[model samples]
Target: MDFDYDLFVIGGGSGGVRAARIAAAEGKAKVALAEESRMGGTCVIRGCVPKKLMVFASEYPGLVDEAAAYGWEASAGAFDWPRFRGHLATELDRLEQVYRRNLERAGVTIFDQRATLADPHTVRLADGTARTAKHILIAAGGRPVRPSMPNAHLGMVSDDIFAMPSLPKSILIVGGGYIACEFACILNGLGVEVTQYYRGAQILRGFDDEARGLIAEMMRAQGIDLHLGTNLVEMAPAEGHPERQPTEFDAAMGMPASDSDAAGHAAPAAPRGAPSGPIWVKATNGSERVFDAVLFATGRAPNTPGLGLEDLGVRLGRNGQVVVDAYSQSSVPSIFAVGDVTDRINLTPVAIREGHAFADTIFGGRKTAVDHDLVPSAVFTQPELGTIGLTEEQAREAHRIEVYCTSFRPMRTAFIDRPERVLFKLIVEADTRRVLGCHIVAPGAGELIQMIGVAVKMGATKEDLDRTVAVHPTISEELVTMRTPVRTA
Candidate 1:
């Protein structure tokens, strides 16, 4: 039963890299990993690292305004996109090198090519070579998918935002998810005219209703033209603009043929690196407008296509996600999958935990399993949102609950006559007095939730929180001081 390696990881993302590193360094097993694109995958390369930097960059203008309100002499200036983008590229490059160095130090072999399942224990690479492993791990992660519509390819995905040659003067962002909302806020903060279209009644659909409502209100106040109950109907390259012509790179990037090209007439390919032109879009609400750019934050799909998993009898979900058990083991005994590829809690931290647990179970002999329940998360909107456990709607359905809620302008903003408000809500089970959920909408909500999450994870009761002393003059102190139930269900 000799094999190429003890374990072969199909992705070099946070999940796959952790598993590979642990198996090699701690488990004392031979490991190897293959990554077609960048070594750090989505989080470091595009998703979180770059996005968070942009979030930081976008916040400076507000900080400058707030500084003036605080009696400090400060003025805002235009953001230089090229300067910031260049720094971001350098940071990403440094991070990728770190990932590679970590894997090498762990004694894991690196393959800079696409890898696919050849058999239960074999992987085929893009270069017509195959390798066998005693165990195979699939953690190829997911990709942002454009909506299936004509001229949709002209629109950029979240990944493309970091690479734009220059910021658009005005942009149309489509979708209601966190990605869409975050970008809407980011672009708006960066001085872009941002129009957001979501077919849903409200944005951040799965979040706490009150928190999301407040966020929607703030987004509009911040000058994002957010239009709920609306969606893009028709889009095309605006006529009379030869600069809007499609290019060979666009075709290679999966842009479909135009109507003229599909009707047996091929349009000339624009030169490489040509700046994209304006897009004319008609919405379902009977409005038409031209935008400098269109960004589709619609959704993402698992990286399963052409992997040859189903052909080898591996079970896959409707969304092309690999189906795995409690320990991340796939239907095939020799195969395993983790991260976004499994469609379970697609957050980067969750993926890392899953990967570590998989390695512990398979190689460390620890038999660890990830607890997916009550995971805390944050959405980095203008005000930020942090939540853990159930939403109020979700908690109300299953338990007799007491909701402790409060909303008011914080001292920092209130002192300056700013209208911004903060909300703190706790959903507690009436009988047990146990906190069922916690949601916060304010600056630093993400940092606040992480500390609060520890208590919630330890099964802290409402009484337990109340007994704790409040940190005076701090907004989070309200978490402990709220004594009255706003409502009981």
Candidate 2:
């Protein structure tokens, strides 16, 4: 069949770019990609890249303290948000250009506009042009969702963080997921008075219970006013004159005078005559406080709406994620979807692999399928968490398991009298002795677990780990040296 292009990709995210490039360069298929925003999608422009930079910035205060404790003269000063933000913006711009250059070099046509599926093999762009393709790929990715409530638009989501003009003096972070907790830590480190309200009993739901518990405890210890079993009852912008003076804590910390009349207040309150800006939140625990900002890190949903897939008889899941077969093929043979838009292991690397596999299978005749199992992931908290494979809870339910776990203050923290602790855990099947999972909670756990993930993916047994020689004075050595079973089930 004659078509405008051999392949048309509906997004410019990691998945879409990879698929478009591979199909054009390696498979020699004519490819066209459309992106409404910056060339690099979530991971590059907003999600992982910017967030990790914030993580590094947040770590400096602690690193300075640790340095002082180690007999080196070190200290951290106030963070200059404007300066750092400018640099970050430049880096993102450079990265976006790199994505553009890569696509151009691969001989893929770029459409800097939104494209939606007009039919199984047809795409309509925002410019009122329709094009037909032999194959269509949807990698439109997901977006953060704010709560459904009155004035919810007044709050910020993860996407808004990069664009905020200035850091808030105080912020109320809502939710318990990694996004919420991570921002709580980041803002707190950056000198914002942070208060987090989570409806759940603990943060980082779906992770190891013990590891997440320790994280919650550590967050509290680090001065995040974390409130669990609590949620927002109602919220409104702070309006009218101050009924009471700003507390001594506020005054000492340089917050605007709470008692000052609307005309004379120095702190930026919600505009005096308007019902916008400073927020008054009433939480479920019978507490009402006004914060400079409220950040909703509640959740994200698939970016499948308005793509015209539903009208074309393409199946979608409950979350509006495109339902696809193992080969990333939609119900219609010529259509496919991958990455967060598919809601399967929504990591950037995973998306890249899925896109590559799709290109190989359909264009290169390589017949590849992405291995979704045993993919390693890291959460960039103050003490990062690196995990791969099943949790202890999941392992126990599937088969008899032996758990090896240890938690202790690392040597560096011990020297500084810091209360920080690291945890190492291994979940093994009792019958076969194969390591079912490895989870680490420590400063560099993310890097360590990447190495451990390779072994676990190769089906390495606990005995294999034990046989590896331990490196002296290293926290990761604990992974190999733990011989006794902490628990058996």
Candidate 3:
């Protein structure tokens, strides 16, 4: 059947853009992409790029102190948020333009508006325009979701952090995931009083336990008020309202007492002329404090609402993610989905790969499917974390495994008497001797994991790693030098 275009891509995120570009340029198929927001999606515009830049900015103050320890006179002044934010805005604008130009060069038509499925092969833009296509690809990505609670809107999410006009003097970060932990460290390094609340026993769950424990310890040492087994009970605006006073009954329940009026009664509402102020949060642990802001990195959901997918009989998961086959094909033959919207490996690179594979299969006449296993990932906290393959716990559950681990202060910081330490661990299948997982907790772990990922993907065995010569005086050298098994499971 004749169509407006050979392919119509909805949501100009990393995945959608790649699919459109590939289908148009390589497959010689006409393509069009519509994006309601910026062209580069979460990774380029708001998530990775801006967050990493903030990570770099936050590190300087700590570096200045480290320089002082190294016999150099260096001291950090107050962070210039306005200056940095302005520069960040400019950089994001430049990146968005780059995405547009690349798509245009690939001969993919760009629509700077929202588009949603109207039928199996039709997309309706925000305007009253309907476009038909031989095939449609959905890659709308995901969004941060506020918790289902009272006054949850008072807290900001990860995306809001990039556009904040000013950094908060004190922030209450809520969550146990990478996003929450990273920002907790970022704010703390920038000299903000960072109080983190994670209801879980440990942050970074599903990671190697030892590594998680070490990161938690380092975060606390760096002055993050990380509270595990704790969560927010309630929060309200702290203007004119007297703080909740603690009663003897509260003390008996192990709740901390308030320093303010100890009347053991509820505070009155804000008065008419009361000046605006910070947030008053009461946690499950019975501690109450005021913070200039609250950040909720609780979770994210796929961008499927109002997209008209379910109306057309597209299968969606419990979390609103598009359910797809190995090749990213949805229930409808003419439709496909990828990226965070599919709830697969939700990394930007993974999405790009999925998009490329989709184009290759449907348009280029080369059937392709993305291998979702062993994708390397990094969490950009103060001290970064990088992991590939399975966690030690995951490996132990499935296979007889040998674990080799090492932890010590690196020379650079150890020389300065810093308390920071680095951890390197490898989980190997006992029978096959192949490395099943690698986890590293240290500076530049992200970069290191990328190189190590190649070896692990190629099915490198423990002996192969051992045979490689160690790079002397390097933190990563421990990866090759560790011979004795820490434990067998």
lDDT of 2 by residue, 1-489 (tens): 899999999999999999999999999999999999888899999799999999889888988988888999988988988799899999999999999999999999999999998888899999999999999999999998878765565567888777666677788999999899889989998988999999998899999988999899899999999999999878765644274234332332232234334674333332211212466889999998888778889999999999999999999999999999999998888899999999999999999999999999999999999999999999888788899999998888898999999999999898778999999999999989999999899998889989999999999999999999999989999999999999999
Q: Which runs in model 3 stand beyond 4 Å of their true positions?
A: 241-277
> Looking at candidate 3, what is the lDDT of residue 10?
91
Per-residue lDDT of model 1, residues 1-489, tens digit only: 899999999999999999999999999999989999999899999799999999999999999999999999999988899899999999999999999999999999999999998899899999999999999999999998878776676778887888876788788999999999999999999989999999999999999999999999999999999999999999877645554554333333333236346575534432222324477899999998877778889999999999999999999999999999999999999999999999999999999999999899989999999999999999999899999999999999999999999999999999998889999999999999999999999998999999999999999999999999999999999999999999999
lDDT of 1 at 318: 97
Number of colliding residue pairs in each model: 0, 0, 0
| Residue lDDT tens for model 3, 1-489 | 899999999988899999999999999999999999899999998799999999999999988999999999888888888799999999999999999999999999988999988899899989989999999999999998878776665667788787766666778999999999999998898778899999999999888898889999999999999999999999866644465343321222222223224563433322211212366899999988987678889999999999998999999999999999999999999999999999998899999999999999999999999999889999998688999999988898899999999999999999999999999999999999999999999999999999999999999999999999999989999999999999999
Model 2 clash tally? 0
Q: Alpha-carbon error at 174 in model 1, in Å? A: 0.4
Q: In candidate 3, how many Å is residue 459 off? A: 0.3
Please give the RMSD to the true structure for each candidate, in Å: 3.4, 5.3, 6.7
Best candidate according to TM-score:
1
Candidate 1 colliding pairs:
none
- Residue 379 CA displacement from its true place in model 2, Å: 0.6
